[model samples]
Target chain A: MFSNDSQIGDFVKSAPKPKNEKERLAALKRLEILDTLPEQSYDDITKIASYVCQAPIALVSLIDGDRQWFKSRVGLDATETPRDIAFCAHAILEEELFYVPDSSKDERFADNPLVTGHPNVAFYAGAPLETAEGHRLGTLCVIDNKPRVFTDEQKDILTMLSRQVTQLLEYRVINENLKRETKIAKTMTRFFENSQDLMCVAGTDGFFKEVSPSFTEVLGYAVSELLGRPFLDFVHKDDIALTIKEVGKLAQGHRTVNFQNRYQTKDGRWLILSWTSSPSADGSTIYAIARDSTVEIQKQNELLKSYEEIKATRAELVRPKEEAIEASNAKSRFLANMSHELRTPMNAILGYSDLLIEEIDSSQPAVIEDVKKIKSAGDHLMRLINEILDLSKVEAGKMGVSRDTFKVAEVIGQVEGLVRSLIGKNQNKLAFDISKAPAAFNTDQEKYKQILINLISNSAKFTKSGNICVRVFEDNAAGVALMVTEISDSGIGIPTDKLESIFSEFSQVDESTTRLYGGTGLGLSICRKFADILGGKLSVKSELGKGSTFTLRLPSLAAKKSKSSSSQAPSKKGSKRAA
Target chain B: MKRVLVIEDNEINQDLIARRLVKKGYKVDFAIDGEKGLQLIESLQPDIVLLDMNLPVMDGWQVAEASKVNPKTKHIPIIALTAHAMAGDREKTLAAGCDEYQSKPIVFDELMKKIEKCLGSV
Candidate 1:
C-alpha cells in the first residue's frame, strides 16, 4: 500500500534503525498525528521554520514504524515517504540540530532515494522536536534542491520553531484528554459544588487558585474572600509554620497524605482540617481534598484528658503508704544519730563516777556512799537511754532477724544465766517448768534469748521475796503446732485494768512501779516487738497483789532438714495483743 | 617499769588514763592526736600502745593500719578504744589488726585487764 501511495518504487528501503526504534515508534504513534489531516497549529510552525531558514521546502515530519509521515508541510506535494529514505528518521537520533551541508557527500544518505529522486535534496537542516522528557519525537526540518549552508541565526530560529511544534503536540494531547473526561467532569462539577468536603486547587504562590463551593460553606467565607487570598492567611496562627512546611513539600513534588492543621473560619472559630493533596505534573499547582475534623479532634482530646485523670487518681490512693514508709525511715536515721551522740557524755559521767568510788579513802565511809549514789544514778540514766534506743529500733523496722535451728531449752538456759544475778539481787526465787518443751525450735536464737531475758528480768524486778516460775507447754491444735510459755510471778501484781497497759511502750502498772521497781518501762514493749519479729504473740493476765502470768505463744516448728525454714513456716497473722 | 603510750585526744580522758596507768606503776606517755600518736609510737617504741579509735587527726583504724604496715612498728601491740560499743566495732578493730578494743568512759579496771594481757603477750 505504501509503494502505490508514494513515488518510492526506486527508493532505498534500509536505513539503520535507532537502538530504541521500538519505543521511539510507539511514542510517535501515541501522538496520533501520523497520516492525519494537517492542522493549522503545526502547519504554521513549518511555514515560519521555512521562511526563517530561507529554504524551498519544509515539513513537520514525524517518524513512524516504516515511514516518515508529514503532519504539516510547506511546499511539499507528497505527504510521506519510505522510512529508509527519510532524513527526519536519522535526525530524531540526534539531540540537537542535525544539519547536512551537502547530502551528496554524506555517506549515510549519499544514495537516499529522496536525495537523488523527486525532491532532489542536496542540503538539509533539522532541529529535533525533543519533548520536555527528552524524547526526540521528530523534527521541524528545511530542505533545498541544491547544496547550501544555513546561517547561525537561521539554525537557532529552526530550533526554536521545533520546540514550538513539541509544545503544540503537548497541548493537543491535553485537549484530547479533557474532551475524553467531559462526562466525568460534569459529574465532578456537581459534586464539587454540593458536597460537604472542602475541595481546592492551590498554586505554588501560596494562594488558593480555585476552591469548591464547599470551601466557602465549611469556612463560612465567600468565594471572593477565599480564592485570591493566601491560603496561609486562613490557617490558624499556631498552624502556619506547619502549613508552610507542607506547602514546601508539595513544591518539591511530594504528595501530602493525611496532613492536618487548624484553620480559622470566617466566623472566628478554629476548624481542624485533615488534608490529602497531589501536585500537578508541572509542580506549580496543588489538587487537594480536606475533611473538617474538629469534632474528631475534640473527641481525641477528651479521651486523652480522661486517661491522665485516671493515672492521677491512682497515684493519690498510693501516696499515704509511701509517705508512712518515708517517715519511718527518717525516724530510724534520727535514732541512729541520737544513739551515737548521747553515749559520749554518758561514758565520761559514768567513767569518772566509777573512779571516784574507787579512789576514795576507806575511812570516809559517808563520802564513799555519797559517790555511790552518783554512780548508781548514772547507771540508771544509762539504762533508760539504752532501752529507749532499742524500742526506737524496733519501731523503725531496723531490727533484723537471723533464723536458725536450736534447742528451746538451750536458748532458755542462756536467758536464765543473764537474769540469775538480777534474780539474786531481788531476793526472788526462780523456777523453770519446761517439762513439755520441744527438743528443737527454728527461730532467731538471739531474738528468742532477748525475749526470754526481758520477761525473766521484768519478773525479777517486779517481785521481792516472791517466786517467778516459767512454764512451757506445747499444743497440736487443728494440725497447727503452737508453743506457749507462761512466766507466772507471785509479785506485786498488776491491777486488772493495768494488765494490758503494761505491755504498751513506756507504761507501768502505776506511777509507783517505775519508782519502786526502777524500770525503764520499755521492757515489755521491746519483748513484744522481738516476739513479733519471731512470728509470735505476747500477752499477760494478772491480779493486783496476787500475781501476773505473762504468756508467750509462738508457731512452734517441728524440726526437720529444710531448704528455707522461714518460707516453710505457715503464714501466721492474727490480731496484735493490743490494750 | 614498762613504758606505756596512751593516744587520747580529750585532756580529761588523757589525764584520767594517764594517772590511772601511773598508779598501776607503769611509766605513761601521752599524745593528743593521731599524727602525734603515730610519731610517738615510732620514736618512743613503748612496750604497749593504747589508741583512741575516733581521734581527730588520724582515726584509730588508719593509725592501726599504718603502724601495722610498717615493719619497725608492726611488732608493737595496739589496744583500740572506742566510745560507743556498737555491734560491729569489735570486728572493725580486729580487721584493722588491733590486738584488743575497749569501750569509752572506760572502766579502768577492765581496761587494765586487757592491757595486762596485751603486755603479757609481749
Candidate 2:
C-alpha cells in the first residue's frame, strides 16, 4: 500500500492536462446537464460502464471549475463531489482512460474527504469524454470499494461509452436548435398565408420562387401558376419595360420603395400594383410586398378624360358667341361711318336752303314757296337718316345708359312743350297729370326724355281732334319701386295683334299707317330699346278704333351695368341720332 | 369784317358754307383738305375756323391738335363742324382744343350762334 500510494501519486502528478480547460468546461456547460435529475439514457450508459468494469458504482460526471457534477449515477446517492478528489475531473485532463488502483493508497486522494468518508471509493477507472473539436469536457467513470485493476477490455468499453455520451450531447444540442428554427419558420409562414398584401420571393433571374396565398386574391392566379414563371410574363406590356428596369436595380443590390407597375391578370384584367422590394445580401433573390392600386388609377384616368371633354365643349360654345359679338360690332362701325357720310351732304343742302330762303325777295312769293318746300323735304330726309342710325345703334348693343338725377315734372314739362305743337297741328287736346310722381329720381334722364318724346309724338300723329294724356307717377310691385309713365291717346287705335308688333323694328299698324303718318316706323322700337337699356319695360294696350296707351316702367334706381356695356360707350356718332 | 375759314373736303359743302358766310357779311375762305386749311390759317389768320372733322391729308382731330400747339394759329377760335352728332363728339373736340362743337345737316341758325359765341369768347 505504501508503494501503491507513491506510484499512484506519481502517475496522477504526471497526467497531462487538457490544452483548453476553460473551453472544455464551457462545452460541458453548453450541454446543460449539471444539477439535473438522472436521465435514463445517461444512466443506462453509466450502468453499462459499471457492469463491464465490474465496479459497484458508475457515473456520467461533468467537470465544473471547482466541482464535479454527475448527470447520471448508479449505486451512488451523492450527485456531486469536490473536483480535487473527483476521478472524472482527473480523467477529463487525459485524452484516454485514467485509472487508479486504490483511491486511499493514492497520495493525491489519501486524505480526500470522499475517499475517507462515506461510499469510501477505493478503485476508479474513467474515460475522458471529448467534443468533436478535442475539448475534453467530462468522463464516464466506474468506482469500487476494494482496490482493483481495470482490464484492457474494460478500459476499451469505458472509452466506447464515453464516445456515445459525446454523441448524445451533440445530438441533443442539434435537435434543440432545429426545434427553434422550425418554430420561427411556422410563424413566418402563417403571417405570409394570412396577410392581405402580396408577399413574394423572386430569383434574380426574374422568376417567381415563392408567392403568398394572397397572390391568388390580388392577381387572380394560383401560386402554382405564378411559381417558376418570369415575373415580367404577368406584367402589362406597357409596364414591362419599367418593371425590368426596377428589377435590374434590385439585382444591383438596391432597394426600391413604392415602385409602381400594372400586372395583367389571368382573366385579362389589369391590376395596378405598388411594390416595395429589397434584394438579398447575395443578390441572388428579392423580397417584395405589392399593394393593389387599380381602383385609384382608373378613377384618376376617368377624371382626366372628363376634364378634357368639358374643356373642349366650353371652347366650342365660346367661339360662336365671340364671333356674333364681333359681327354686331362691325355693323355698328359701318353705320356710324355711313351716317357721317350721309349727313355731310345733308348739312350743305339744309344750310344752303336757309340762306336761299333769306336771300329771296318777299315780292317773289312763288320762289319763296319753292325754297320752303326744299327745306322741309331736307328736314324729313334728315329725320329718316337719324332714325335708321339710331335703330342700328340699339341693335348692335352699342347704346349705354347714362344715369343722372332730374326732376320728374321738369322732364314731363319739356316733353309736353316739345309735343304741344304737333298736338295742336293734329287738333288734339294735350293734358298732363304728374302730381304723384317723385320730385326727383336717379335714372338715365336723357333716355327717359327721349322715350317720353317718342310716345307723345306717336300719340299726336295718330290722334286728331282727340285728347292726349301724359301721366307720370310712382308705382310699386314685387318689392320694387318703379317710375311709371303712361301716355294714352284717344285717336286711331291699334289692333290687339299690332300692339306687340308696333314695338318691333320698322313695324306699323298697317301699310297705310306708314303712308298716312309719314313716319320711318322706328320711333316705338327705339323707345322700347332705350327703356331696356335703362333696365325698364315698355308695354302698350289698345283696341281697334279706340286709342293706344303706352306704359313705361323704370326702376327708380339703376342696377349694375350690363357686362358689355360697362366697358363700352354709347355708339360714338349714331347714339344722338337714335335718341 | 370777321374772316372765317371753312375747312371741308366736299366741294358742295364748302361752297354752301362759304356762300352763307358771305351773305352773313363775313369774308369766307375755304380749303379742300386739312393741310391746305392749316396753310390758309397761317397766311390768312382768320377770326374763326369752321373745321371739318373728316378731311383729307390730316383729320380734324389732328388738325385741331396741331393748330392748338402752334403759337400763331392757337388763338383763332375753332368751332368743330362734325357730322358726328354722338354724345362724345363735343367733349372729344373740346378736349382737342375746339371752342365749340356743331353736328352736320347743319341748322344755319345754330351754326351762326356757335360762330358768334366763339368769336365773342376770343
Candidate 3:
C-alpha cells in the first residue's frame, strides 16, 4: 500500500451509477466513436488534458456496454479495456470530476488490475464528457503511474478541455450528417437538370423561384432570363387568364394535374404544355412538371383544318350540280306546259276542220281539198309538239320505262300493221325476216314499239321504191343474250360524217333531209333515248347512197327502272299518244 | 234527245262543244263559268254535265263539289274535261267528284263514246 490521501477518500469509492444507463449508452453509440482511429482533433484534446493535469497517460474514451473504447490516447498502448476495470466508465456516471489519487492506497482501486498490473501505482483524474442533452457518454481523463494531486485551477482547466472534447464530438456528428445530406441533394439536383420535362418551383406571387435546365432548353430562354419573371408573362395572351386561374388553385393549396396551356417561347413560337403541379406544404410555392405538346396540338389543328376545307370544297362542288338539275327539271316542266297549250288549239283546228268538211258538199272538190289540207297541217303541228315533249323528258332524265313480257311476233305484227300504210305511201315493199326471233321477250313493250316505229317511219320517209327489211334476232355476245332488231332500207343513206350526229337531239342528216322528209328531226334521238332507258343501245350503219340499217339491241332481261323516273309513268292519253 | 250542259269559260271551246253535241242530236245548254254552271245544273237538269277545269271565276273542282252535294243534281253524270291534261289531272278531277274524265282539244270520238256510256248508265 501507498500513502493515504483525503482527496482519494473524497472521490467516490466505486464507479458512480447513473439512473439512465441504457440511455447513456445509447447516446454514446449515437456518436459512432467507439474504437475509432485516433483522429487529430480528439488526440489534440487528450494531449492538452494530459499536459494540464501533468499526467503520464491521457485518453478520449467512449464507454460502451461492457467496454471502454478509446477514440484517442497518449502514453497508452491499449485501445480498450473491460468496463468494470475502466476508470473512464466510472467517470461517465458522474456529473463532475472523478479522482483516484493513489490507487494502491484507495480502497476502490486497491485490488484493481490497473493498480497492480502493467503501468501500475496509478493516480487518476477524469472529467465526464456530456452531450448537450446532459447524457454523459464517456470522459476526457488523465492518469499517472505514481501518486499525484490536482489543484483547483488544473481541475477547472481539465473540465474546460473535456467540454472542448464534447464540442468536437458533436461537431463531427453534425458534420458527417451534413456531408451525407449534401450528397443526396447533389444527386437530386442532377436528376432535375438532366430530365427532359420542365421542372419548376414558383412562389405564390406567380414568379418562378427555381427552374430546371429543361425549362431553358424547351422555352429557348436562359435560366437567368426566366427566373424571377411571373410565369404568366411567358404564356400566350389568350391563355393568360386560364393560366392565372390554374395558378390560383395551386396557391390555395390545391394540386392540379395535366392542366394545359400555350406558352410563347423566346423565339416567338407557341409551345403547348401539359402541366402537373402541387403546392408546398406551407402553400408558399408550387412544384410543377410540364410536357411540351406543341407538335401534337399542331397536328390536331392541321387535321381539323383539312377536314373543314374538304367540307367546304364538297359544298362548292355540289351546288352547281344541284342547280343544273333544277334547271333541267324546269325546262321539262315548261315543255309539258307548252305541249298542253299547243294541243288545245290543235284539237280545235283538227276537230273543226273535220266538222267543216262534213258540213260541206262532196261535189265541190276545191273546198273539200282545202279543208283536208288544214286538217293535215294541224296534225303535223301536233306531231311536232309531241316530239318536242318526248325529247325534253329524255333530256331531263324523267323518261319512264314500263316493263312487260310480250310476244315477239305480236309486237312485230303490230309494228307492221301500223307501218303498212306508211310503207305503201312510199311505194316500198316491206319484208319481215324473223327466223331467229325468240318466242317471247321481257322488256318495256311501249319503248320497244316506239323504237321500231321510229326506225320504220324513218326508212319509209327516205325510200320510195326499195324493199325495207326488218330482221329480228337474238345475239348472244359477252355471255348475255340481247334481242337485236335490225331495220335495213335501200333508201337515201346517211353520210358517214352525219351518222353520229343523227342520234343527237333535233339532228337530221342534213337540212335537205328535214325539208324533203317533212318529219321532226327528234325521231332517231328519241328512239336512242328510249333504247337507253330500257338498258339497250340503238346504232346505225349507213353508206352515202346505197342503203342504211338501224339496229336496236336490248338486254334479254328487263332492267329495273332508274330511281329518278321510277315514280313517273310514261305519259298516256297525251300529245305523246298522238305521235 | 239527251240533254247536255257544257261548262266552259273559253268562248271557242264552248261553241265547239255546243256545235258538236247539237250535231249529234243532243239538246245542249251553256254556262260561261263554274258559278253559272252550278246554277244551270238545277235549271236545265241535263242528262249529263261537261265540266271544264281551269275556268275563270269558279274552277271545275268547286263546281263539281257544289253540284254533287245537291240532291237534285247529284244523280246527273258529270264528266271532267280539262286542257290541263298532265298525268295526275284525271285522278285529281275524278277525286273532285266527276263521274268521268276527258282531256281537251277533245278527241270528239272518244268524247262521244264517254258521253254515250254516261247517258246509257242512267
Candidate 4:
C-alpha cells in the first residue's frame, strides 16, 4: 500500500517501496522499537556511527507504517518524520547501505522539505537494519547538512552499526517471554504450598520425595519426620495391601482416582484418606492429592448402626403382641372343649334321673326323692357352666347378637317364667308395671330375656319374703326412644363400694357371697356385656339393707329401620340368614 | 312307626336317649359313633337322626354333610346334638346340612319339641 505512483501533485515525492513491503513492515513492527525511549545500548551505537562517519547527525531509525521513528538519536532536533520524505524509508528497501551523495541532486529527495527549506541541501545515507530472517527494517545512519560523498569505509561502518541495533531489538523480545514464564512459575509454586489438600510426590523407591505443607497440618507430623520415609509405614495395617496395589499401578504410568485408605496419625489415631494420583511421564515419580475423610466415614457407620438398632427394637416390640394373640386363641379352644366335656355328662345324669323318676312307683318315694336331688344338683351345675361359658364368649368379643322386632310382653313373659322357681326360693313377691312400655321394640330378644332373668334371679337370692317389682317404661327425653326395664327389689342391699365391682366377671358383693348364695358371680358381668352388644347399658342403684334397682335400657328402634322385622318370626332365624 | 336314630359316643347318654325315645312312643335305634349312624341311615331309612358332635370315625357335622349329599339317605332330617355351647351353633350346624341344633344337658322337653317339629316338616 506504500505506493510511489500516488505522489503526482506533491512537492515531496515518496520513495519507492520494496516488493515484500508488507513482510518488511511486519519485521520492523516485531522489534517493537518504534518511538521507544532512547536506550543506552542503541544510543552508544548511534554515537559511534556519528563520530566515525564524521557526520553531524545520526539515528537508529525504524520504518513504521506512516512514519520513520528513531530509537536513539544524536544531533537530531525531531524524533520522527513523515514516511513520504523519510530517508530511512528508502534505506529499508536496500540490501546494504543506501547513499544519497547530495539530497538536492536526488530525484526522490530534491524537493523534500528538509533539503529545500531551512536545513538546506544535505548528504544522507542509511544502512538497512535486517533481521536474521533477512527482512530489512530501517537503518542506523549519519546525516550532514551540505552535499557530501560517503566513502566505502563509511558505508561499511554504518552497515555494521545497524546489525547491532537489530540485535538489541531481538533481545527485547526474549526478555519479555522470560518475565512472563517466571511469573507463572511463581504462582504455580504458591498454589502447591498453600493448598489445603495433601499434595505430594513419591519416588519409585516408595519414599515421600516431596510433600506440601498441608500434610504437616493434617497429620500432626513435622515435615522432617515425613520426608524420605516410606509412606506405607503410616498406613493402617488392614488397608496396606490395597494401598500397595494402587501405588503399583501409579508406578506403571496409570492413574489412581477414587482410591481410599487409612493412615495412622502421629498420636496413633487412624484417619481415612481419599486420594487421586497420576504418574510422571517417566513413571519414576507419582503426584497425588488426598483429603481426610475420617469424620465422614464415622458418620456413615453411625447411621448404619442406628438403622440396625431400630429394626431390632421393632421386632422386639412386635413379638409380645403376636404371642398374646396366639395365647387368646388357645384359651378359646380350651373353653370349647370344656363346654363339650362337662355338658355331655350332665345330659346323661339329668336324662337318666328323669327316666328313673318316671319308672319308679309311688311305693318307692325315698328313691324318687333321691332321684329328684340328683336332677336338682345337676341343674345347678349346668347353670354355673352356662354362665361361665357366656362370660367367656363376651370376653373373647365373639358373642353374636340376634336382633328382632318383638313385643315387650314376649320377653317379659319369658323372664317371668324363668324366675318363678327362684322367686319361690325366698318367697319374693314379683310384680310388673308396664304402663309406659313400648308396644313393639326392635332389639335382640334372647339377650334381653337373659338380662331380665339374671336380674330377677339375683333379687330372689338376696331377698327373704321381700317384694320384687319389674317396671317397664319408655322415655324420649333425649329425642330418641329408649325402653327402660327397671327391676327393683326390697332385699339385703349391696354396699356402695361393692356396687361397681359386682359387675366384674367372677366378682360378688363379698367373697363369702359365692358360698352363701348358690351361684357363680359371672351372671352380672354377662348381663352387662349382652346389654352393651344390644347397644344399650345396664345400671344399678342401691341403699344398704333397703332395696336394689337394676335398670336395663335398650334402643326401641322401629321395625322398618331394623334388619329383622317381626314378620320374620321371633327367633335368631333372621341373624342366621345374614351369616 | 317314626324311627329315630340316636348317635352318641357315651354309653350312658345313649341309654338315656333310648329310654326317653321309647317312652315317647317312637321306635328308637342306637349307634355309638357317626360311622354306624350313617350306615344305619341308609339301611333303616329312619325318619330322623340325632347326630352327636363328639364321636369316633366321624363327627355330627361330617355325618350331616355326608347323609345330606347321599341320594339313598338324603331324605332323613338330621338334628345336631352337641355339648359345645358356641353361640353360633344354630347357623353352624345348619350350614353343615343339619336340619336342627340343640345344646346338650338337653332339656328333654325342648329337644322333643324340636324333634317333632323337624319330623312334622317332612
Tens-digit lDDT string for candidate 3 (A484-514): 9999999989988988899887789778777
The residue-level lDDT of candidate 4 at A297 comes to 81
- lDDT score, residue A438, model 3? 87
Candidate 4 regions exceeding 4 Å error are: A1-197, A202-207, A214-229, A241-261, A272-397, A402-408, A432-445, A470-485, A533-535, A553-579, B7-12, B31-39, B53-77, B83-85, B91-99, B117-122
Candidate 4 local accuracy as lDDT?
0.84
Q: Cα deviation in Å at residue A400, candidate 1?
A: 7.3
In candidate 1 chain A, what residue range of length 10 has the lowest lDDT sum? A570-579
What would the TM-scores of all predictions be?
0.59, 0.61, 0.59, 0.69
lDDT of 4 by residue, A1-579 (tens): 232444523757777887778988887766666766778998899999999998889988887888888888899878888888888888887787888988877777777777766555398888888888777778888889978878888888888888888888778878877788889988977988999989998886788888899999889888888985789998998998998889889888999887999988898888899999999998889999999988988898899899989989999899889898888767866775686568767777778888888899989999999999998898888888777677767767767775567788877887888789889978779998887798888777777888899889889899999999999999888777899989899999999998889999889988788889877787898899988877888999999999999999888645445445555575667678888
Top-scoring candidate (lDDT): 3
Q: What does candidate 1's lDDT look like per residue over A60-120, in tens digits?
A: 9888887888899998999888777788887988888999989877766666777767788
Which scores greater on TM-score, model 2 or model 3? Answer: 2
RMSD to true structure for each model, in Å:
13.0, 10.2, 10.5, 7.8
Whole-structure CA lDDT of model 1 = 0.83
Write the residue-wise lDDT of candidate 2 on A105-211 in tens digits.
68766655566667888888888878887888788889998999888888888989999998887887798788888999999999999989999999889899999
**Interface DockQ per candidate:** 0.13, 0.43, 0.20, 0.48
The digit string of per-residue lDDT tens for model 4 on B1-122 reads 79999888888877878888888888998898889988999999999999998789888888999999999988899999887655557667998999998877777888999999999999
User: Lowest-scoring 10 consecutive residues by lDDT in candidate 3 chain A?
Assistant: A3-12
Off by over 4 Å in 2: A1-243, A252-278, A281-446, A471-485, A492-522, A535-545, A551-579, B9-16, B22-25, B31-43, B53-76, B91-97, B116-122
Relative to the real complex, the DockQ score for model 4 comes to: 0.48
Off by over 4 Å in 3: A1-39, A42-322, A333-381, A394-397, A407-414, A417-421, A433-441, A473-482, A510-518, A556-579, B1-18, B26-106, B109-122
Error of 3 at B91 (Å): 12
| TM-score between candidate 4 and the true structure | 0.69
